[model samples]
Target: MFDIYLPIAGMQFNALILVAIGFSVGVLGGFFGVGGAWVVTPALNAFGFPMAYAIGTDLAHIFGKSIVATAKHRKMGNVDMKLGLISIVGSVIGVEIGARNVMYLTKLGIAGPVVRYIYMFMLFGLGIYMLYDYMTKDKRAAAQAAKVAAAARAGLAPPAKKSWNLPPMIHFPASGITISLWTVSGVFLFTGYLSGLLGVGGGFIRMPALIYLIGCPTAIAVGTDLFSVLFSGAYGCFTYGIKARVEIIAAILMLVGAAIGAQVGVTAVKYIRGYGIRLLFAIMVILAGISVSLKQFQLNTASQWMVMCAALGMCAVIMIKLYQGFKKEQAEKAGYAVKEVKP
Candidate 1:
């Protein structure tokens, strides 16, 4: 009933499915500070859209959604403007390189399987590492504390934290870090390359890099990454459009749902803690990897259903957390008011 003809891609697709996919990713994107292209591209492809068209349409929608997500993050003081600006310089150049590579691969008639395999590898590798990091954080913290205490007892200075500390260090007071300019640029460039290659905003990779590599706090990482994503998404959309890969009607339908969903996702960030967000992100990506794997194995129907179900399930979890947190906050406010009146 909701089917619509897309002239750009020359296909009939369900409008409701596009909107639903957008809403799911919108919530995930706003909370996770990702463009959610990882989700959108795969979901679209599974449902019969061509790989190139899926990527272009995904990037186009991401550009609009990031605006809403970034604005909300900025208001919450999570954005680091300085870091975000630096990221754009490297990212833009890197994206151009990656986009050209995709075009070459598309011409070879091997874009589909090749892209899916790479996507699966990235999702699984990153997700596993994050889970391991979360599991070992406390042990690592204790070990570092012990080393400091040992040094102090021996009348020696505390052990120095190791870093590159190359010349021309840059300081970001918002994230409370001072690091080499080279390191920041290198990280963004690599992420941008992946963004162009994989039809992502680079937020999934960059968010983790900001926290682990650059030493930004997780929340700051989320906000700052979104700021960077805004630029990359814009560039990606334009480049893909020029390549004649974008489906304009599909992009618009997705954007409508994303706009509303972004608001809810951003608000949920207030209720969830930094570690909580990381854990959820890890799980989401791992599930995404599995979905892509199913596609690689020729189980197209199963892959389509798996991704849609996972997106809906994750969205439900986030909304429930938000509701619970809101109720608790209200109760505390009411209790405080009662105590003040009694006095």
Candidate 2:
């Protein structure tokens, strides 16, 4: 069904399939501030991509996609450069350590299963937890609103800082917060370690961690995560490039699709509510878990079907959301124009 050249993955792949995969993952990466390697690598492998080339090609595309997404997000005032740089520093160190550990595990002959199981557990557990959080989000929002009212009535100062206050505090003007350096480093290091070990951009982990742990706004979390992914993906590309795993031609095609998809996704973010984004993300991850499980059980065909369907389904939802959002935004602008003219 496809053709290949040495060190190049599926040079003759169904061009539509490759483009679709690239576009879908690009949208996800833009929306979630991740490189989407977790999805792309597996999808490529399922579609006859060389195992070695899959990851490298995925990373190569990710680097390009991240650039597109980050640039757009930056214009939208979503990126926090200070936090992003810190993430890079911590993640780079963590990645080295994690990679070394993986090498050690590989020597024991249980590395493959161990890594796969860990990936599965993380996906399922994170999915469930996010779903639960989404279900209870309204209650939490109401409680916070009540707290704000009570504070206003009491004439108390706005909420006090509750950050852990570990040493070496760093302030981020863009994010409008100050956090302990230790907390920042520790969080990025852990996420970075996961990235290296799992051969992912760690956007899933980093984005969630940014929202819940670092306490960044959802938009900022997405932007900052993408910034970090750019660096990590570049490093990955280089590593795999030296090993002759990166297919430049395939990566170029994917990059074109990703560029367009990233714009759609970044624009959609402006229209969607934070909770809505979280809900969609939870569903996507849960389905990803099912796909991974199928793969783990040696049901390659089933795994591919599940993943492709899930991805296509989710992509449809995102595009629809983006369309609706664009329409609504446009209507509001038209109304504003009419009002100004009347006055």
Candidate 3:
């Protein structure tokens, strides 16, 4: 069972660590409707795994986790099968190009810095934007509510419009919106490229894009994102595996843990509101950005402690999110009981 040792590193197989990492990633993945590959790849790299092996192993684990999450989301009627299928073709092509670029960068001895820099920029930028958006939205909601109250005091009704005026709009029975296909395709292309470049499941980006850009409801965005990730991640894993880039044992161990974690995450989703999900996701991304930035420092300074710090920070974020999710679930249940007693 421990036959495949890392001769260069002089380390034996540690199945327990792999399982723990997988389980943690799975919980985050399910809760945020993400693939969790971002967490897995960096964590593995911190453990002294080569970049190629880490990415491949992470992909395999994501493939399995995606399957579980997608199934759950599908049951909840969140998946848009047609859109997911179309996105798969684009995701496959993007992954191939991105994987090739990774190999090229590795050969040039610059992959680590380049990847870390990209991660730092993307994560931090997105995190800031999401945080800003949430804050502005809260203010806007408060203003709107106040306006409505004033109108009631004046004996006038609030606005009756339940829609907006967006051009070239077409109705989506699933989303119940008249959004443009151009908007959808543009988002998917970006999502596909990001998934390929970062070796992530792309749900982190896709969920927001779907809700904000495409005007899908939060539940639909989460569900549809999982459907897209299921295919995209499987394709990525297969491509990497065929190239012998995958570590099957590591991937399997992570998947085993992720499977259980995914279930817990999915259950927690029932209790979390849309704004709450966005806030949690933004916080996670910011922490992830910090972790990747620390990794960049490790690479530049050749500091083992920095690398360990990055790994610990990331794991801490995951664990915190998981605890918060469970807490939210419990709070919701307690609220229900209080409501029942009130009546």
Candidate 4:
């Protein structure tokens, strides 16, 4: 009953599947500040969509979903406008380059496997690194504290973290980071290229880059990455449309679900703290990588189920957290009000 014709992709796809995928990804995108393409592309491929078409359709939906997520993030004061704007320049350029490379791979008839393998590698590598970062955060903090104490005992100031002092350093007041312009450009360019090649919103890559590389707080990184995603998604949509790779019908269906899910996801971020977000993201990424790997092994059905299950499970966790946090906040407000009335 939910199946619909997709002229662009020349297939009859289930509308319910599209919407469900969009909804789950929307929640993830909003909370994680990612484009949700990593999950969407793999999910679509598992369901028999051509790799190129999956990437294109995923980008189209991401453009719409990002608008909702970004607006919400801005209201919460999570966006770093200056840094986001700077990222757009380098990202757009890198995206074009990556897109061109995909077209070349398509001509060689190896785009599907090539893209999937790259996705697997990147997902595993990034997820493991982030997990390590989260695991050792306390140890790192203690070491820094010890250094400060030793310095104090020696009657000296605490030592500074070493950094590049390249010319034309730019300061982002929102993130409170000052670094070389060259550094920012390099980071975004690399992230953008991956986005183009992988058919992702590049938020997954850029979000962490913003945190570890650019030194933005986790929430700020999430918000700022979404801001950059808006532009990249738009460009990806247009370019892919021109190449006749986008499935418009599927994209619209997905957008309908994403719109609603984005609201819930963005709200959840308000309740979840930085470390909490990071840890959850790490787990999700690793699971997603495993799903993609399954697809590479020709277990398409298994891959589809795994990714869908992961998305649904994560959504449940996020919603429960949101509910609990909302209740706690309400209780606190009630207590404060009662005290004020007594006075």
Candidate 5:
């Protein structure tokens, strides 16, 4: 009853697993403002899905998830439509080129090892950097708060605003900052290519790039990233679909769960601090890196059990992130109520 392709016992898959994985990835994606395709693609591959089918199905699911998350983030006043639109154009071109590149790599018989190694190195490096940044930010915030307290006690004015003199800066009405368009375009181009090459929606990289490089606030970055993903993912889905790489049934099932999870994730963001978000993201990415590394090892050794274990480990990491985010949200709410009553 739950099977999608039962005619071929060796290759048939259960629908329940697809939905569950989708739901889990969706929650993480929404909360972290990422495509979650990294987790989805590998998970599908591990489950006896062909590489092409997995990429296509993952993109389709990402398109749906991105639409839902974008709407939610827009409602929260987090998206920058103009920036997102510009990024989309670049992303589409990049995806096309990336798809072609992947095909070329496959022909050369170097796709698997190259992709796996790149994923491991990039994921691990980014994860470590994020964790370190989160820790340092927390410490800095504490120190700043103490300084502000000391100044308050002394009845002195706060520090003067720092100034920079630069011309040709364009104003972003949404961000309330004047920045160079060159910087923005460069980021978009890089993110676009990465999205295309990795078969991801690019939210993971785009969101952070917006926040750090473009200097957009976290909420704005989340919204804008989702908006960009909406376009990129749709294009990705269509491109891969035309190649007969997508699995419509699998995509639909995953989307069903992801859409709902996205709403929950968007809501959760309001209750968590930015550092908290970074910390969770770091942990999840690190776990994902570990899982991928394990799978690579398993493939080298021809260990079926190890491969399965690695897949399960990835799922567990995602679940852990959800639980932690939920717990943090609840704690924040309780703390807020307590403070309100005391005051």
Candidate 6:
């Protein structure tokens, strides 16, 4: 029973449905270090919200949800405040430049198709690369695991350290990394430009960049990306509010659910490994690419259905993984408790 008056969307909807959608996306955002607006906007549109209102309301809720998730990550020592702040500065400039490019292309009367093509290329390229990384890493991890096991059996020491050792290095204490300043700037600048060009929160792009480019641990990348998402989402909320596109009542309802989901998602990250996150994220983004391609072909119904399925399907998979990990941890704790009881 959708029954809430949303002034901006100019409609009534089941508040619980909004909450459910928010919760699903919130889990993804918290776990994957993205704003998950790509999931949210289309889901809302499926529920009959005006496209503009859907985007605005989703961003508004994302601002609040990011706050919740970021605070939790900070406590977990996952967030690197220095890196996050620098990212904000670089991204803002990048976003502006990206926006300018869009405007220029629009003037050329080929903006829509061009943007769609870029979007398709970016998603497909990133997804394919991540998939490749995951496959290659499996072989590497297996070899390393075998070597370590053999060493322990033979009473030999562990492997030697190899340094990245890039010059003009900058240290992020929270992420426990020292990488080149140019690398950091270039990463954020490119991600920010993509955000501006695609009119997105850029969490998905930034999260991968943090992992593969800057070489942050997966957990830290999730935390740090959420930190960036917080500011970006807040800015989106404010901008949409001024434009009268945000539906406050609906957004508030969604925020309630998002808060809870963010907690679960963040906790799930503790249980999952870096590889697991990458594999799932790669799959998710590939689905998103399919959605965009469908849209480009003017298959409107197919596009919406594809995105909704991707959003919901991915959310379900995340929740199941979280639950499985949580149960395993609980069983381990129980075993420890029994052992400590000593007959």
Candidate 5 lDDT over residue span 189-268, tens digit each:
77777666665577777777787777787778777887877776787799888887888878888999888778767776
Task: Say which candidate scores most in TM-score.
Answer: 2
Provide the lDDT at 63 for model 4: 95
lDDT of 3 at 139: 88
Ranking by TM-score: 2, 6, 4, 1, 5, 3
RMSD (Å) of each candidate, 1 decimal: 2.7, 2.2, 5.0, 2.6, 5.1, 3.2
Instruction: Judge candidate 1 against the unseen true structure and give its global Cα lDDT, from 0 to 1.
Output: 0.88
Rank candidates by lDDT, best first. Answer: 4, 6, 1, 2, 5, 3
**Stretches of model 6 off by over 4 angstroms after superposition:** 141-167
Q: Could you tell me every candidate's TM-score relative to the true structure?
A: 0.89, 0.93, 0.76, 0.90, 0.77, 0.92
* Model 4 lDDT tens row, 63-85: 99999999999999999999999
At residue 208, give the lDDT of candidate 3.
Answer: 84
Whole-model lDDT for model 2 versus the true structure? 0.85
Model 3 C-alpha lDDT versus the unseen true structure: 0.73
Q: Which runs in model 2 stand beyond 4 Å of their true positions?
A: 1-11, 148-161
Residues 1-343 of candidate 1: C-alpha lDDT, one tens digit per residue: 9999999999999999899888988998888888887678778987899999999999999999999899999999999999999989988787778878899999998887777888899999989989998889899999999999999999999988899989899999999999999999988888878877875677888898888888888888988988988887887899899999999999999998997788888899999999898989899889888988987899877887787788888899998999999999999999999999995
lDDT tens digits, residues 1-343, model 2? 5443433553567667677789998888888777887678778888788778888888999998999999999999999999999899898888888888899999998788888898899889989998999999889889888888889999996576476997789999888888999999999999889877876778998998998889888889888889888888888889889998998878887898888889888888898887788888888888888988988999977887787788778778888999998888899999999999995
Candidate 3, residue 199: the lDDT equals: 57
RMSD of 4: 2.6
- Winner on TM-score between 4 and 5 is 4
The local distance difference test score of each candidate is: 0.88, 0.85, 0.73, 0.90, 0.74, 0.90
Q: By TM-score, how accurate is candidate 3? A: 0.76
Number of backbone collisions per candidate: 0, 0, 0, 0, 0, 3
lDDT comparing candidate 5 with the true structure: 0.74
